[model samples]
Target chain A: MIGAVPARDATLAERLRAGRSPRRRAVDRAGRGLALAATLACVVPLAAVLFFVVAKGAGALNLDLLTKPAKALGTGGGALQSWLGTVQMVGLATLIAVPVGIAAGIYVSEFAGHRAARAIRFASDVMVGVPSILVGIFVYVLLVLPFRQFNAFAGSVALAVIIVPVIQRTTEEVLGLVPRELREGSLALGVPSWRTTLSVVLPTARAGVLTGVMLGVARAAGETAPLLFTALGSRLVNIGGFGEPMDSLTLFIYNGARSPIAALNDQAWGAALLLLLLVLGINVSVRLRSMGGVRA
Target chain B: MREDPVEMSVAAPVAAPPEPQREALPTAPSTVPGGAPLSLAPPAAGIPGAAPATVPAAKIEIRDLNLYYGPFRAVRDVSMGIAANQITAIIGPSGCGKSTFLRSINRMHELTRHASMDGQVLLDGVDVYSPEVDAVDLRRFVGMVFQRPNPFPTMSIYDNVVAGLRLGGGARKADLDEVVERCLRAAGLWDEVKDKLRAGGTSLSGGQQQRLCIARALAVDPEVILMDEPASALDPVATLRIEELMLELRGRFTIVIVTHNMQQASRVSDFTAFFSMGEDRAGYLVEMDRTARIFTNPREKLTEDYVSGRFG
Candidate 1:
């Protein structure tokens, strides 16, 4: 019987080792080629945008472009005022939104019942897809009209509305990635539910969740439509507190892009380059940090 | 812990019914309102609540336990005594609910949605499921080690050992240091890990990580330790080490282990309880006795068949 088994197995092995037919080989090659094409389809556009911005914007770059405020009528000055407004407003927006978004995310992932979680998740998904112009209009009606002035605080609130959904959704997804085993292990140690969620679950998911927060900040920094009806853009540096009008990089690019003056147009390209680099820098660093760190 | 994946159920022939014990256990299903009719399998022979006078005082006594997940009964009419400061091994075929029965002792099964139980699990004669008894406090006394080695991924080795005490309240740094060393030594891991207390808990190898989890369990100073197939995921060498540790810990804590490995059960346990699934697919205990008696001369034919490697 053993000899018969070897004889049968030899035939099976011979059949399995038979080379792929010409048609199958051709199909496999075509599939590989198609996948490569799809990948290049994504990369080519991104590479072109980066190349064009650097090529056009690098010539316009100078210390004066970043450090000095824009000229009164001409384009002989920089976007110090614009960039500062962006920093303050986005920072303020982060302060307002991070706590609320993270708290809701934790509640949905760790405590809510199935129906409640689903409802909140659905609401956030819808909010993520809502138009930024609509958010600007809503803030216009809610804060700008009521206060009778366009203020940096109103702009921060508008950006915050856009940011909350991104942070909430990403926080929920990242927390979900933490293994159920970790929670069980903590609970089995006789730790109460709240302590388990706070000390163990949150720390385990910290890096991934922070990456989400950074992405949200990047998204908020580049928004112009929401600030159009809120901050309303200022030409001269308005050092007046958050209650006054503000100018941001996005607002600077928007106004500069529309100017008839050639210098102003060139400065628009420089501002665009700076905005792109900032967003790209944040995304790259976060990706690298999450990829290289040992999760344990 | 949401409904463990069902193991393939082997069709076990129906054995003759056991003689019913006195004191018909009242069924008080915790989750199901208007207590569901208890259609459980016939109760088995080991009722330590009414055992012969010579049995040692039971550290944990289970009385007519039936566990359910949603509507399906998983463990049926399990009543046995785990002797004080001794090791009791629960051995069974896959899908016979050995793990479920073990979890019920510490109320760990209640973590699963729709999980409920009927009857009593007494810890030192106090009904652990009583309303006034906090489940979290109960867990502090009855610690568990899981099948997989799950050390907190973000904590340092030292932090993982002191997690329970630190969470409960303040512990002096000196006390924490002392507990860490004592528990790690008890778990046979101090020599391997003493120099790297600040290293991430998950930096250790799989066997060492399992020992870390054991040391974490030991640090809480639990009166009873429940190990649910704690060494099954490990290699032969690691498995032997865990067995040796259990033997070393035998008299200090009442240890209850659920294992699929019958050799492991015989090697480390003082008493052995054999479980088998009835025709309805709810697991019930067949017999419980001294390990030597269960292996050499069993009261039930099923236990003999299982221990002799004739069948599971």
Candidate 2:
């Protein structure tokens, strides 16, 4: 009689310890699978684009493509002229934009209540959303057409127009990130307000500002739409200012890719590859600089 | 268990010994016809019902003071005087305008664009809020330390201590070095930080940073020092050090401190003002008296309740 009762109790315990409901188990498995699928979906496109660019462009990248000038007439040569033009124009644009952009950003972030600052911020936001081609047209009318010619200056102005809003917006956002206690501490020292901003607040946000400026440069460097109307195009290497037409890699690619000759097409690919590498190198440097700032 | 009779006599008074009846009170030096007495003594009883004028003739006096932030009134119709070379602690719970009262003394609240005040703040018998008196100069006379120790994070300890002196501008190298040494010593931090003068102020421990801030305030040689919860962020040992420093500071500079710690008020202050909330949550000073009497035998029920930890 005792053995029969113990056996019955054991059977009841086994029934109570049964596995999870089938529907709940299926739902948990499906949730895990769905999360995995979502993550893969987001990553796949980025990996594919990186793979395609490296695979298609790596063979054409060499020192010659970087050091020599573009092809003559319909023949293959190099991208030195286009490369130089890109550098000069972007360099000039940066020189013009960084100071004005950063100042405007500081004004907006530091004096948010002022009417003029509000207007400037609004205009910057509007400008950022405007198409690059519109900026090119605006510059063509306001600058290039007035001179009756396209030149490196016109190209730079167009690029500056595009870059200014980006730098201003990013700088304002970064400056806003600096804690108010830092500013207040300096002010409490009887330090004049402007000096406090320059000496204490700006140094704290320097890395973020630099990263923003570099990102602006990267964005403006590859802009084919703006340069199409501003710099026009040229096969020969020229170093003149606003008076003469200039060469750029984007224009070189656009013009060369249309050529019937196979050699010209190959040179165009090399120029494209060079542009990519330059931007990539800059991005890597910016990342390293940001990491260094974090550690510091 | 043997207390001296002299100590008992000195400790017995709930209020200052009634100013030797008017006839015996010393008159001011007659250098200037209408100049007030240099001594910080309570006013004689010429006017009736003036609440016995507990506060002495002012190192600092705020008269009919009203503070506003846009539409909201923070402190209203408040008047008080801080005595020379005494420690006055303003104790109340959070948002009772204790910190506000402290900041108003140095005009530190004026840095806020929306903050405005209507009243007279007299420092050394001169109206600090007068149009001719610069806020910067006012701050030099009445330096302040905040609730949190903020020692200019980017600056070295030496620079942090000397910042106000440098801002005062144009002192010779010997004078500056002397002042830095004197102020750091007064702040009780010179011995610990003497070797690390070049290290960043932020590299110091929390208590050290607070002491550094005190040193920074001392560097300016202000006649009055305002501290708002200066020791609240520190550990007990650090807090004791700061309290001891306050006592040391009291011999030289008049100090006004705002604290939530009732025990701190009793331990470090010569006078304590008990502030409490009213119908609209507006804070008003319930009583100001000798610290010993305020703790042991407060006159006001609210003051008694707060000190006894019955309610805040």
Candidate 3:
């Protein structure tokens, strides 16, 4: 059995029992509806793209598509050469970009003086905003012109240039979030500044840094314009060396999409789906691993 | 802890002395390598209450120290001797440069951008700021604990304790294990954390985390430990435990603690230095004396007023 509630509790219960006025309730519902509409505005385009890609590309998938190289105009072979080139070029680009990007990030966040840090940050921002095609042209002039060849190395260089600024900015932001207290604590224990940064600061921001790297990798893997000037798409596989022309999934999609034949266009859709899945798979796996990765 | 003030107050009246006494130098002046002469005489200006009472052994001597953050003076003209094997508490209100003064002892203050200090902070009679001394090397001799518990989030309980030792280069696993156990026990956290030495440092509660930070500070075996309000974030019970830990460790290390809690200063410290901000917003030492005398019968009117709750 319950006894009489205290005066304060009684008042609180009475207040709880009261409902908002009709005008206020209507306003609340309208606000919630607006929020839902805004959310759908963001999600609808993404859902539509995924739905159409799967619908159009699923029938094009086959063993032949996987096994054969590109055939002549209108006729189909496969994206074997393109897939391999993408793997090699993007892989090399990652190797070049990650270390340089992370090092530059660390310098800006942990070591650079005020004016120097500002200048570096400004340069990175400007690099990020520069058009991807311009990066391709820049690399063409820098590496292609100097070497007298449109080679996979120049394509990888352009991709790496594109990736570096994205990774650098993200790394700097993530490292900035690592608390100042952690650095001070480590330094007070007689650990040098550089050691503290490597051990304590970086590890704490590991998951975030990995996320940034994945974003950079995904962007580099999908870039077609940059590869156009440098890689100069090849129908035959060029796997012997970086000095030869290369074919990537983006180039395959570009060529197939523009072809007059319906079959090549379908294959283009298939390759787009494949590239999207590959990037998605890498991102999902990395996110899951990082979630369970380190306590920091 | 409640009974502490009562017992100390009873002893306070009996322990009062008529005149202030200077702390005797702990060791001979020759111990200062490079023959840096020890200035035995008090400062010529003889700032009031600067040297109010005696301490057992002087471990660190600060002479004419003025700390600046860019153009603003934070701590001005502080001269004092921190006693070895004892806890010296620095008490002041907010923005009074209490933490700045503590950081200067370990040269941690210089880590802040635009932060600088002149005059001498002598560790074993050698100026720590001398061109020959490396700040990194000097930090090995003086460890510090911040107000917030900052156990490395990336490390486990055991790893956090050995983070400092790991820097000197790899040590035998057995040696690290021993250091971990010894420091945890010294911080009064061994029994609670021993079973889960591999657990994340952040898995512990607020109180336990603070104790872990203390254990981390102790791991390097520094001769002096500086605490900047180490327990201000904890509950009263945890605060008492930290105070007890400081008291127990006083026999082995020189401890300089900056606290906002007056009762904590009166309870845990052997010597108390009261700091107050001047009109220009620069903090300076108002009085330094035995804990008992400083609380019971301070010589300066400002010290008495602040202690009695008349004003800050």
Best TM-score among the predictions, by candidate number: 3
Q: What DockQ results for candidate 1?
A: 0.50
Chain A: TM-score in each model:
0.90, 0.84, 0.90
> TM-score: which is higher, 2 or 3?
3
Model 2 spans with C-alpha error above 4 angstroms: A1-38, A114-120, A240-242, A257-261, A283-296, B1-51, B163-185, B191-198
* Cand. 3 Cα-lDDT: 0.84
- What lDDT is reached at residue A61 by model 1? 72
User: Residues B91-130, candidate 3, lDDT per residue (tens digit)?
Assistant: 9878999999999999999999999999888886778999
Query: For candidate 2, what is the lDDT?
Result: 0.75
Who is ahead in DockQ, 1 or 3?
A: 3
Q: Ten-residue segment with the worst summed lDDT in candidate 2 chain B?
A: B1-10
lDDT of 2 by residue, A129-220 (tens): 89999999999998888889887898999999999999998889888988876676555556566766777677678888988898889989
User: How close to the true structure is residue A281 of candidate 1, measured as C-alpha lDDT?
Assistant: 81
Instruction: Provide the TM-score for each candidate, comma-separated.
Output: 0.87, 0.82, 0.89
In model 2 chain A, the worst 10-residue window by lDDT is A1-10
lDDT of 3 by residue, A203-229 (tens): 999988998899899999999999999
